[model samples]
Target chain A: MKLIPYLVYLLLIAMHEVIWRDVTAIHGVTINLAAFLVLAVALYKSELTVVWFGFFAGLILAAGMPDRLGWHALALSAVAFTAFHVRERINLKSPFAKFLLMLGGLFLHNVLVVLINQSGGFLYLVWHSALTGAVYTSILTLLFFAFKDGYVTVRKIRDIF
Target chain B: MTWISRLFSRHSRNLHLVAILLLSAVLIYGNNDLNRYVNRTTLFFSWPFSQVRCSIEELSGVNAENQRLQQSLVEASLRLTELDEIRRENRRLRSILEFEPEPGYSLLPARVVKVVGDKIPVSAVVINRGQEDSVLVNQTVINQEGLVGRISEVWPGGAEVQLLTHMANRVAVRVAESQEMGVVKYIASRGMILENFPIQGNIRQGDLILSSGLGGVYPARLVVGTVASVEKPEEEAFCKVLLTPAVSFSSLQEVFILRPD
Candidate 1:
């Protein structure tokens, strides 16, 4: 059962890497599906599991990117760990809270990656790409969460009827 | 000792976080070697997926063919005028001397495999050709329409191209008609902006922009774009000129890497 979830996560990461290029991009900001996945996992899993999963996911992403090698791994791990701790204190069961968490996580990830790589034009990247990416990723996370969990509430209402 | 054991039990998460951070530091320290290995593995894994994407793109091309044909028609018209000028110049040079026009550049065709940061204003695309195909860093990339970008990173089987519109990218360009030189830089919210042209320079809307060959990276006279709008601020020493890229980046599928001889 544990193996199944891990395989699913791996599959999601692989699919994200392949299909993300095709996603509709607005001003070059697309939904960060990988970041969303990390946040989702953190909400449900233990701190240790989330950290390892994030690290591995980041490692996989760094493989395709041309930037510094461990930047993504480090960024993702840090974001996941932060998200896990935040989840313990917050009401992440709510869609709004999840969206907020994802927004912060994605922004942090982008900042870490940019800073680690020492990419120039920091202001332009932050204002144009990072913020837009955070908003877009947050919207995507909300939709995904609703799709995955909203059905349960709908089914319960149907049973009541 | 009991208290120490209790602290470990209660704060194990903190320990794990520290351990991961240390691991991350180690990885960063050995980043160069690890980057090569990771990039190789990524290329190996993503190769099949790239092929699949290519196939899907081909299938979708049927619907896009009409649009491409229309674009080709426009490009053909532009090419005709450019060819006529070249022919006149060649004839004039031939009359003056027994001269053989040097073949300036050769084109290596490559397929775009992956696009990165498309949603972000800072963007790049990965092409199928790499060092094996002699695709080197700083080589100019172009489609039939016009300039696409420049190759930034090259591996064995793949390469990454930093698009001309990327924030960090700057190209030296000149107005074709006026011969006024300027540096084209990508500005956020705004597209490509050509700056540092003299305020008195006669740059106008629809003026063609070409690479000035001032920089060693891109060759001379490659069509970069046209001046979409020009702003002559009264207080500033330079004119702020906005450019509309000749090549449509959103629809780019195939491009040629120019190998200058």
Candidate 2:
């Protein structure tokens, strides 16, 4: 497959980690774009491609924190691998099914991140940051999935007009 | 061997996952130097963006800081104005403390309670001291500056002092330098004119006019005013001398009743 696009995706993930993570955060909640992108790749790309991309995305995401790099990379790879198998087993013909999968995946990833980074306040963070972040990211994922498919199209709009 | 190759291909993904896990375990438990390098590199790239972000945050806070500073400025200005008024009052009180009344007359400090007038702002002012304070009618009222007025009416608790600015008020005064005598009276048309003074008196502009003790109403040697101008008309018998009152009548706050010893 093409390597250049994957490199660009990794760069985008790094950009999001450093710049947009805090800027786009609402209150204390933030979007887990690295996990979301990894899950998206698992939905379409091959299992090997998904796992590798997830690993690199994790590295880029946790680049600011050097001590957590290896664990984050491993965790993202595991998430990609699991999501790939789940996609293989589940019938995700509709965008709704894909949206649900994305929501679940993002929530799991957010929980993992909180567990890795936080020294205390596990249950509180799970309720506040992890849950809200998952929901916030899921809404964006749903919109993305809807646009990616022809659920609402330009041609359909022209015909309606 | 062909069976072994198929097994290897099938389990390649699992082996890769295990490898990633081991690498991550190393990063998590050890490799501080590696982590520091990675974090430093990340910060190096993100520094410019973070600077911009900090500036934006500070800019947002500027409006709140500005409003807070403005409020503080207003409070400080009001406090300063109050302090200035207090300082002026303190200076007046200091001068009043140093003031000494004429010999054989004791000074009783009194605050001006109420001022009554139509044209001149304070033609008559009621003092807090009355019969209870031993303040009697015709008693001379003076302040730190000089002669203010004399007690006109006295009640059990309060007394009204007629200021020298009043149309009915008169003070027998003399030129301090020449000792030339004149009766100073207030007229609506011509302010405090020295009357009954000879046209040939050795008086010039800016001569000090003091109470001459002739009327038996006011004491002698008390400063009343300074000679503003002396006009000796050819038709008039006496010189028409104008005087600038030494006491600032409009700002009268404190006064002393000159009671005999």
Candidate 3:
């Protein structure tokens, strides 16, 4: 609910956008860090918070990219909304479920981006780029979740002291 | 019953989602007006990252530079032999006809700042130079090896170059040895393909390919690539030619913008 966390998320997204191209690109496929972040927030945060996070994160990414401005915002918001609804209906406590959610979110994001851009060879693009990117982002999401959990545990121990 | 309380009611979340989506749709519709400003702002924010990218490139470029230098040395030796043959031919041709060679063009040096759209096969790269340096859209970009790409968009302090490897790019090129002309295009995973050349034409492996200046987009005779392989399919009217680009896109760092006087 605090504005500070939202601003911090935006800042992290901005920094990720700047460096991810160089650090994460492999064989022309890159991890969609923004999408992963959106999914992570959706899984952990309140519905309203996740929705706003998705929109703002998408906005930050769209601003930096050359694609049509709203594509990312729309995609992220939709994915976040879906993830939030899914979270309400099901238990997403399992790592496998979280990974699947991450992949689905990234895939939906990529599909929206391609469609909005009206890029030619839609099927080929989805198969080659979207799927690969989803897998890469999902792998990254797993690592991020592990790190976050470890950090949370460490904080809890420190609080007890 | 206050307006503020109503705005924060249960439906407020849906309202926020709809509002954000609507705003995004509006922005998308009116993107042209905001694109330049957004790109400039992004460029400003990405400056530090660009510096870091340059530093990393510098650190890693040493081995690549050494390999390139060694390769160039071998090429120089071969060129020396070719130059002697060309000199004799030039003398013979000059005696037969009065002609003048084309004047050399000056190059505006620029450093690459970022590569965009890495997830897709087609992507553009951002360069440090911009309109301030007289860099214009569609201007030819090259490095020491050969043609890199053409300027696609130019902002005040930066420009985006659509690399020849981009699927949308179609280059008018000619075989240097035989003067056979064709259009070179990128075919996703297949690299550069020179199409529309007659199967019977003198296209062959190792023949130099250069920009023919037919489309008026690029200058005449800029080195594009070499005929990597020539395939004459029995079913097709034209030859299937692959090119090994003169410039290695992966190792691209410094490039020159050819601004014809």
lDDT of 1 at A27: 65
lDDT, residue A20, model 3: 64
Q: What order do candidates take by lDDT, descending? A: 2, 3, 1
Candidate 1 vs. true structure, TM-score = 0.46
DockQ agreement of candidate 2 with the native complex: 0.43
Considering just the first chain, candidate 3 attains a TM-score of 0.84
Q: Which clashing pairs does model 3 show?
A: none
The CAPRI classification for model 1 reads as: acceptable
Interface RMSD of 1: 2.6
Stronger candidate by DockQ (1 vs 2): 2
Q: Write the per-residue lDDT of candidate 2 for residues B5-52, one digit (tens) a residue.
A: 897798987777776777677777776887787667656545666676
Ranking by DockQ: 2, 1, 3
lDDT of each: 0.79, 0.86, 0.80
TM-score for the B chain of model 2: 0.77
Question: Native contact fraction of candidate 3?
Answer: 0.42
lDDT per residue for candidate 1 within B46-121, as digits (tens), equals 5666677778888789769978998999999999999998897676445434422227887787888898874755
lDDT of 1 at A7: 49
Badly placed stretches (over 4 Å) of model 1 are A117-120, A151-161, B1-19, B42-45, B57-261
Task: Give candidates' CA RMSD values in order.
Answer: 32.9, 5.0, 32.6
